[model samples]
Target: MNQTAVKRLYLMQVGSMPEYQIPIVCYLVQTDDNRNILIDTGLPEFIPEEASDFVNGQDVVEQLASIGLKPDDIHMVVSTHYDIDHSGRHAAFTKAEYVVQRLHHLDAESNPRFVANRPQWDQPMDRIRLVHGDTELLPGLELIETSGHVPGHQSVLVRLPKTGATLLPIDAVPFGEDFSRNGQDDGKNPDAEAIRASTVKLLELTEREQIGLVIFGHDRAQWEGLKKLPEYFD
Candidate 1:
């Protein structure tokens, strides 16, 4: 059996917003085979004026540096969605292949709200690798389509050698309270049905795979209890 092993998993607190107190974070997964996979890039300098006070000084590059990594060291960058908070700093990883859903790319390009913040992700389109639906980036790293908050938002699932399974439901299940309720209709999420279905799907997967940990996207309370960078989950 060709079992893939994730050697290390680090959570980088790249940015934060005061309104929610949930630190915007990014996840780095180092596989035994020397692959460095990054999930989401935190907020960019240009955010909504209302969120101006939410900006954290550390950019994605600086956050990666804290763990002895450079932006170019990332082999792949998986965007859970194209929301400014999640995809803003994506341009930093110029050397990495930007993996995103086809629908997500289209939506970001056409949606006026996202288009206004285009400068943050104003990188060459050639760097994008658009996939339809769910796709596997590596042996144990899977991108699960859990769109709800946005038309093409997705989440990540990692099966580690030591940690078993870890589910990152990104904005699809933004907070612990939402996950606990099976899903909540945050005003921003236009499609309540999709959110409910996606959350249910994640719960099913967690139970079936016996997932060891499930990370919610913007859970302030939950984030406080997690081990941040430097101290990783092996």
Candidate 2:
């Protein structure tokens, strides 16, 4: 039999970052071999109305149900970082092996920014597969180590059979201006140098791989143009 590849990519809008007025996203990848991989669970079960600010969508579990997937159906979970919006629903999945960069996990232990989110992403050590630097987690799926947005932050690249390779530089390059402008400091992350380097790395990869589809982390314009769930990329 031929090697399995990602057969479907689902883009799910889990909530909105009201302060910035952009939709918060998470993704689901269904492989041709009947495996599912989740990329960054959305918000937690509850948040004060004040904290929610304005728009908020369904939780990750609920979103998964729309396409007939439960928590256990997921085989792997990739945590790009521990930011509140990205990792809030992580505790919902107990069966999947969580993947994260070792340094990011270490930094999360003491870094105030990430420490606050320990409860969300600090899964059992037995189930956490901490990798250093970049790695190909699956045949067609590769994790791009792109720190600076936060320490040990990582991005994703999924090469599908029909749709081709897609670059998902989650938070590493959240906005299109980060690309057209050559990755300027967004004032959100102080590690501007790291952010720039990671951006350039992703850009070079995008060029070398000839990747045409790039699903950014929280770009409203980009999200609006995408083929959202119920519609798969492949």
Candidate 3:
């Protein structure tokens, strides 16, 4: 794989919402060397019906196959955050090494504000790898530490050889417009300051990195414009 040649990456929105009809996204970052790296598995049906309602319906495994991938085919699983909707049924990627920021995980479980409000993802401790700081998953893909929404929350930064750079902001700012209107304050969570700081960090990153794309956790419009799996980077 030539570093000089542009690499194409893709996003797969597996689950769906009845309200919006938008699929819940699970990313697939293909490197120059043909490595398949998955990010954030979707929710499974095993969870309570009410809890599962926020997620998209299609099985994440089947969704991957629609794009020519099986669960075992994934090399690494990058979790942006531990929200029930985002974490989904991670057990599917039994063979992939899970990656997440250490601080984000600790804060999510320990912080009174988070524990009291969004306590869904506080899973059993044995789930996956608890990473720290920053990690480079592949040649051009790196996990940047941006923890605002939850303690262990992080986002992905992919630098394709040809496309320059793209930042998968995750839930740092729920939507691209969050930063624009100071909507970082959720009114419910007390971590508003932390969330705002994380958003600023992302803004700084994209400006400095010359990022061509910015992906969010639930940005339906953005995902709709992106190339999906199996047909990525054509």
lDDT of 1 by residue, 1-234 (tens): 755567778887777877668778889999887888899888875677744766765777887887788989998898888777787788778799888888888888878767745765656778888889888877778888987778888899987777778999998887877775445965655688888888888888888988989988788788889998888887
Question: What is the total number of backbone clashes in candidate 3?
Answer: 10
Clashes of each: 0, 0, 10
Among all candidates shown, the one with the greatest lDDT: 2
Looking at model 1, the pairs that clash are none
lDDT of each: 0.81, 0.86, 0.70
Per-residue lDDT for 97-128 in model 3, tens only? Answer: 77778886676666654332243345455655
**Candidate 1 structure, TM-score to reference:** 0.91
- Candidate 2 has its poorest 10 consecutive residues by lDDT at 47-56
Residue-level lDDT tens digits of model 2 in 68-160: 989988989999998878988898898999999999999888877655556879888999999999999877899999998889999999998
Q: Could you give the candidate ranking by TM-score, starting with the highest?
A: 2, 1, 3
What candidate 3 gets wrong by more than 4 Å, as runs, is 1-6, 19-23, 50-52, 107-127, 181-183
In candidate 1 the C-alpha lDDT for residue 126 amounts to 88
